[model samples]
Target: MNFSEMKDQVINGVKWYFNRNWNRDDVMNMDEISDEVHSTLKMNTRIIISMLTAYSFGSSVGFIFNYLFKVEQRFVLRLLVGITIGTGNLLYQAITTKDRREIYTGCLKYCVVIVFSIITFFLLETDTTLRMIVIHSVLILFMGYLVIYSQEILYNADFGDIDYVNCTFNVFFHFPGIMIHATRLYLQGEQQEEN
Candidate 1:
């Protein structure tokens, strides 16, 4: 085909892919809808409690660091907090689901965190401003991940899949605690500066 014709075909293909609706059913039957509701709510309470426990543990650590240690580098503490909570949540999910693949994935994700921690530990001796910049970048990415993760949960719940509700619960639970801790730190700093 000529170049113009090939370009047209590619554009058409892209449009078709994006426009396609994967859910074949125009409307879910009443029985299927009822099943979806039951499945979505089945273990929601347990998931929420587990998530809160993990988040509280993580945030408690961050709080100590911020208030007691006077760590100005809040993002570093935040990362450690996130890793702790994420690891606990992942293991809990794997245990409850009894899924080997999820277990492996969780391990892999933790390995990344471990590597990051090791690197951060070494870099702590470097220039403070540089280290803060790096930590800030990582924190931004992590926050973005949380936002996307929450959206994924909402989408799955709306679509009646509910497969990753545990993951969603953990993200939602962990983030607010961290944010509150950060806000407290800011307020404390302001008070101290005023003094």
Candidate 2:
């Protein structure tokens, strides 16, 4: 293909990736729709609670480490700590929950978090500001895609059957470390500029 044709194809591919929808269109009665909405609200509430719990736990750990060490270059250490805590939490849930589906869903959600964490780690390792910004933008887009895909999967399954709380907890458990890393980078940049 010609250069222009290849460029057009790449642009179209990106557009398609961002715009693709995975919504279900099954016709249902008003009662069924109301029931679905109610169940969704309940599940969302549980998920929000799980996310808050994870965030609080992760933030506490991160704050303790920061307070104790007073070190700026503890991204790897924090990542390891987050992973340990997240894994322990997941294992605890898996042991307590009798449902195999819940266990599998939690595992899948944890895997997704790990994958994104690794990607962010590498992307943020770049020293150039412009490059980092570009990479972060792309990362945001990919994360948005992940959110859409995850919602599609969750909505398609029986909401009550999945342990969405634990799954969401697993997904958000690493967020504190990521936030810390980003803040560290920003502070370092500021210091460099000031110097």
Q: 116 in model 2: Cα distance from truth in Å?
A: 23
C-alpha TM-score for every candidate: 0.29, 0.28
Number of the predicted model whose TM-score against the real structure is largest? 1
Determine which window of 10 residues in candidate 2 has minimal summed lDDT.
22-31
Error of 1 at 162 (Å): 8.2
Please tell me which predicted candidate would have the highest lDDT against the true structure: 1
Model 2: runs farther than 4 Å from truth?
1-34, 45-128, 131-135, 156-159, 169-195
Look at candidate 2 and tell me the lDDT of residue 131: 40
What's the count of clashing pairs in each model shown?
0, 0
In model 1, pairs of residues that clash are none
lDDT of 1 by residue, 12-112 (tens): 97655333121212111112223443345335524643665556456546456466434564454555565555546553543354333443455456556
